[model samples]
Target: MISTLTATHIQKSYSFEGIEQTVLSDINLTFTQGQLYAITGSSGSGKSTLLHLLGGVDTPTAGKILFNAVDINAMRQTERTMLRTKNIGFVFQFHYLIRELSVIENVALNAQISGINSTEAYDKASQLLDHVGLRQEKLKYPHQLSGGQQERVAVVRALINSPTFILADEPTGNLDAHNAQALMDLLLDCHKQWGPGIIIATHDAAISSRMTHVLNIKDGVIL
Candidate 1:
């Protein structure tokens, strides 16, 4: 069965020199399985913050992030890390590919770290790369690839384990229009063919319009 991830009564704050600043407040959202969701807002509107909290990379000042009815925030750090590795994937604005590793190695590294045999991991990664049209560049380093190619490799890394969902933060922000659309096309193909839910945080309406749900936020509250 596909998992349901929900954020309830979420709030995030940071203290700066004895002053409290809030990044998100009373935010509540439920992500259904196998659907595309877009969180739309200007920068600082808490889109990225929400993704971080949902992904278990950061804790909320208040509220619980529940996965299949269990509170993820209540998990031990190591447990949370394991859950993230096995069930959740993240794509950031930057590709964040390792400079030293070949493209195939970059995608397979997580699977190998999770205890899969190296040969099995590489075999699986090779299949994903071929599906994403990067088979020819598998042995190339990050510097040898273009920006779009680098980002595609990052997406492949996220999908290595076939996570239940992916949280993408401004994934297309750094790409040109053509490349941005191309990236989205690949994501859509994955969503349909592979059956993973996608939650994308973006400022572009054109991109947001394609999502099944578009959530507009301002000053940290959904509109």
Candidate 2:
């Protein structure tokens, strides 16, 4: 079956002091496995907020988010977290690798959290590291690697669970031109191999131009 992540008329609002601030308004979208989607918008355009909602990181003030037709928003926090760990991968703007763990450990940690055998997780992590040319650095700590390498490790960590969807927020924001392109190339390579639904939030037009399924958000609405 084709797995899907659907957002239905989602609305998100925050009450600061006495006023209400809406970040996303009546958003509706469905993301299918094995496709890539690029969400492009300027700063404070609600791109990140929309991603957070879709990833089940936050509850929508109105409407519901369904994963495989079940309302995830209604699920308990624990259940939602479990669902996210097992089915959704996330690559953030900064590489959040544990400062103390070695490269392989960082990548395999996710799979281990999902209850995979340690040996199996490590083996898979090794192979993925090798694929991304990080095998030599597997035993090294995060601070020992370059910025691009750290981000690549983060990507592998996200893919460790073989999640059906990947939500990347400004993943390339910190890299230079060369490293940024290399990182994008690496992500596409992973996408081609793993066939996950890759949704990236980026302000770079050049990157967004590469995706066939592009979404532009403006003023909390899809344009």
Candidate 3:
């Protein structure tokens, strides 16, 4: 399988009070197409930072992140943004849906941003919503749905563009056990069907155990 993402000697740090603190250090990793990976760590363990770097949301202090063999860290901001929008999907702990938009509309927003016509975007969103068992709630706004439902909508939105990689940060952190399990099941199902590489940062062992591989982050290094 082709490598979808690669991180080489990656390091990330932050400056506070004129002191530099390293969050991630000397990390090297690779994600292949159609693979499912879990990043596990305790609080403040740099899992989220690594995920952000991998998704092109942030740059590494040193080293390189490559998507489809192209260096992301070296790209201009606009170019990186376009690359992310075109090839990467993100799901966070919060649904981050627009309260005013309907469920289907929220999902369609991503497609629209990707330059898909509104009509086709809505059609595709509707299909994805249905696949996630949210067809009945298509017209409901985010504020009108339960937390679980909102997260489900977020997942569909992430997948609307059929991105090459899906990067999720504690996607189930806010859900109850039942809802969390359901969401994980949906993610796994999507992975099996669509074959997109998935890299999720999570603390839940149950979630990590189901992945194709699990890497633990400890004191700023992959273990």
Question: Residue-pair clashes per candidate, as listed?
Answer: 0, 0, 0
lDDT of 3 by residue, 51-87 (tens): 8899888889999999878899788889987777778
Residues 5-124 of candidate 2 have per-residue lDDT tens digits of 999999989899899999888899999988889998888888888888888887899988899999998888888888888889988667689999999999888899999999999999
| Poorest 10 consecutive residues by lDDT, candidate 3 | 86-95
Question: Which 10 successive residues of model 1 have the least lDDT summed?
Answer: 171-180
lDDT of each: 0.87, 0.87, 0.87
lDDT measured at residue 190 in model 3 versus the true structure, 0 to 100: 77
What residue runs in model 1 are displaced by over 4 Å at the alpha carbon?
143-145
Off by over 4 Å in 3: none
